[model samples]
Target: MSSYYEDSVTLVAAKEILASLVESWALFRLLCLSQNLWAQEGCFPIPIISATPGSVIPWNESVKILCWGTPESYLYQLEILRNSTFEVVEKKLGFQEKAEFLISHMNTNTAGRYQCQYRKEYKLSEHSKTLELVVTDIMNQDYTMENLIRMGMAGLVLVVLLAIVIGNWHSHKVPNKEDWPDFPELSRSKHKCQTGPLDKALRDTRALCGKAYCKPGNKKTLPS
Candidate 1:
């Protein structure tokens, strides 16, 4: 006849609450942008995709970054930085068919906001997305529901908490860039991502081109 059962249930509830916060924070606190564009105009000349490290990526875990672009014949270049200073922590040069990258052996140095740099034809293409990776000391924290509720204000707190339990239940991201499963196990691939903005743009461009040339009425007129 121990009171331990009450503590166990409380722990479960607490985890549910805080997990929700982590998710909502990830969804709303982010702004996705592409860096590939015309140099002088800074115009996004091509469609591309990528993954920015998110807060959940665990220590020593690997995250895959993917991206593609217009002028499908061109190559793709990828780079990673752990901070806003744009410090180069990892680099891959002259990659013609690289769409994704697996970040492994992550440590403290790898923990931070991650940005994916896209390059095409020596010109910068659109950036994929940006996300932050924060390592947690799960071993030291109790992190039950009550403790988590103490972390946020009442504003949208319930909704955010719900989102944490329901994320990935309603839909999946279009492969542009995101971390999944759990941040603590980031070194592994939780799922596969096949599409992103780059993939969508490539598909749209091809579809449009097909309509212009293959459709019935859009024929080119000869100069009379």
Candidate 2:
């Protein structure tokens, strides 16, 4: 009786050990499957990123960056790196499947490559393809053109004003009559207060007339 009882107890203990081993193996398999599923979900798809108004943007213009990912992803991270300096310029976090980042005014400093990644629970997805951003000097270009136009207009105005002034000055000048050449007919009437043939003839004629006209009663001789 005692031997039979001991064998029964031993058999019961063996069965319990087998059951525990089976349970442990099943749990291990379940844990592995869970981990594998999580990893597969994390790596299935990558995020997609794009820039609004194209990659090349004008200076001082607003720019919008969009990041898209699977709906399962509850969080996203956006990053920007400047190619010239090889430095990270921005990092942003978003809680939605789609994220948007806005740069109010794009500049040289804000121009570079961009990327994004998604996270679900503790797993992170691969970063999206690189998107390049280029900021152009549109403002400077316009300003230079405007300056040239203004300069040209100013120069033309100055030329016109100078021409008008020259014309007015020429028109206001008065002619000097003394600078004119003398006429032959007017030379005889002109007197220089010097004794000449004309003057002597006139004096003799005046004396003869006085002598002929004088009467004896006057007796006064005409002075020569």
Candidate 3:
């Protein structure tokens, strides 16, 4: 039978090479219980951190942070992630390879995430990525809104004043008919003056002249 079909195809290639060597020895025993196995055997380097006046702060002020590491390191540590693990908080012990921490009056429960590590004698390293932090202010926005409101009010007042002035001017610009003299009365007074006094005087003078000139129904002779 072809030697039992070649030993069942060599026992199915030796069970696929013993299941790939038990999945690489269980990933090398989970990286030897990991503590960042000396930065995964690159020999320790992974430390860095940072935060000094940045990472957005403003509630109560004060920060610092910093980390660096690896010049033979020494100790360091720093953590702070809460509710999801991290913890630690402080340790120190370095110097020329940096370490600092500070954190004075912060607030809002000290913001959030952070990290840092280092050790160097029995090796530790790896753990500097996270950072986050934050706090804020809205004073600027408030000032801007207030200024806009003031400007709008001023403009409205100016418009109202202008309207008042225009209305006043219009009221006085036209004349009122009642204040003028009547045209017909003026014309009648002028006609009366032209036909009065002089006419009466001329009539009286004619009468006197008529009487002196002759006696009615009488005749007279006179000798010189």
TM-scores for the candidates: 0.34, 0.47, 0.29
Best by lDDT: 3
TM-score of 1: 0.34
Query: Candidate 3 residues 1-224, lDDT tens each?
Result: 99999999999989999999999999888887685754556767778898987898877788998989767778898898989999988898754488889888777788788998888877677798999888665443347778899999999999999999999999888677986677755688687678767888887767765663445654542223
Tens digits of lDDT, candidate 1, 74-147: 44444446334655444555544455556675667666665555455466655556555666555554668766
**lDDT per model vs. reference:** 0.57, 0.80, 0.80
List candidate 1 stretches off by more than 4 Å.
1-55, 71-84, 93-98, 141-224
Per-residue CA lDDT of candidate 2, range 1-224, in tens?
99999999999999999999999999999999999998787564888999997898988898888888876677777777744443434455645668777888988778788888778767878888999898889645658778899999999999999999999998888757995678665454364554699888988877776674565577666665
Residue 89 lDDT in candidate 2: 44
Per-residue lDDT, model 2, residue 83, is 46
Specify the highest-TM-score model's number. 2
Q: State candidate 2's TM-score.
A: 0.47
lDDT of candidate 3 at residue 54, scale 0 to 100: 89
RMSD, one per candidate, in order: 52.3, 9.7, 17.2
User: What is the number of backbone collisions in each predicted candidate, taken in the order shown?
Assistant: 21, 0, 0
